[model samples]
Each structure stands twice: as structure tokens, then as C-alpha cells.
Target: MLIIATYDVCTTTAAGRKRLRRVAKVCESIGQRVQHSVFECTVTDMQFEELERKLLAEIDQTKDNLRFYRITEPVDLRVKQYGCFRAIDFNAPLIV
Candidate 1:
């Protein structure tokens, strides 16, 4: 499945800043970042669950927001992009 992950982490406190970095690090390991706080990930059901769990842990329920948009169709068939950030094709090879 194609999953779009976006997060808003509080930066007003030291702990909040730490959580922000942790969330970004976890997402970066399993997905491609398209925006500063949004990511495009291609993951299996189990992978998705684990990713969700990891992300949920880094956020304070009352002070942060995290969204996961599950795209049911093929990614390229549904996504739109503009400017310098290239659109992501999950089925294609991603050279790091």
C-alpha cells in the first residue's frame, strides 16, 4: 500500500524537540521525504503497523499531530507534485 505520513511536532520544549527528531529519523529510515514534514512510504501491512507504532510513540497525544493517508490506488495514478520536489513512484528503484 502507499502511505502518506505527515507530522507536526511541538518545538517549544526540549523534550518536544527530541521527539521531533526521533519521528523524522524513524520515517526517513523507511520512506522518502517529499516535504519537510511529510513522507511517502511503500510498506506492507506489517511494516505499516510497525511504522505507525513507532511514530505514535514519538508524539505527545495532546501536543502533536500525525496523519497517515492510505492511498488505495497506484501512487503515480493518484499523486500530484509541483516545484523542485520530484513526484515519487513507489514501484520504481530508489537510488540513495
Candidate 2:
């Protein structure tokens, strides 16, 4: 299934900054970064479970937030970019 994952980790302290980087890295491993804190991931059931576990371990329950929206229905995603908005096609074949 396709998942839209987003997170916000407090960066006011050193620990928070570290947590933010860790969280981002986890997401990056399973998905592509659409924004600084947003990612689009296509994961299986087992992979999704592991992703959640890793993210939970890196976040502060009281200070950080994470959200995952499962995209089950088809919807239109349009962009109106003036510059530097290089959108990635998650469904396209990756050319190395």
C-alpha cells in the first residue's frame, strides 16, 4: 500500500535535533523525501510495521509528532511549481 508519512520533531534542544535527524533517516530508508519532514512511501504490511517501530523508538512522545495516512483510493495530485519543484514518480521505474 501507499503511505504518506509526515513528522515533526522538536529541534529546540540538542536531543531534539538528533531525534529529528534519526526520524528523517528512518523514513528516508523506506521512502522518498517530498518535503523536509514529509515522505511518500510504498510499503508492505511487514515493512510498515517495522517502519513504525523504528520511528517510535526515535521520537519523544511528549515533544514529537508523527502521522501516516494510507492512500487506498485514487486521487489527483497536481503541482503548480515556478521553479525547483522536481516531483518524483514513486510508481515509475528507477533508472540507475
**TM-score on alpha carbons, each prediction:** 0.89, 0.82
User: Against the correct fold, how does model 1 do in TM-score?
Assistant: 0.89
Error of 1 at 92 (Å): 2.5
The C-alpha stretches of model 2 lying farther than 4 A from their native spots are: 75-86, 93-96
Model 1 scores worst on lDDT over the 10 consecutive residues at 73-82
Model 2: per-residue Cα lDDT over 14-34, one tens digit each: 999999989988999999887
State the lDDT of candidate 1 residue by residue for 30-87, as single tens digits. Answer: 9999999999899999999999999998899899999999998755678878798785
lDDT for every model?
Answer: 0.92, 0.86
lDDT of 1: 0.92
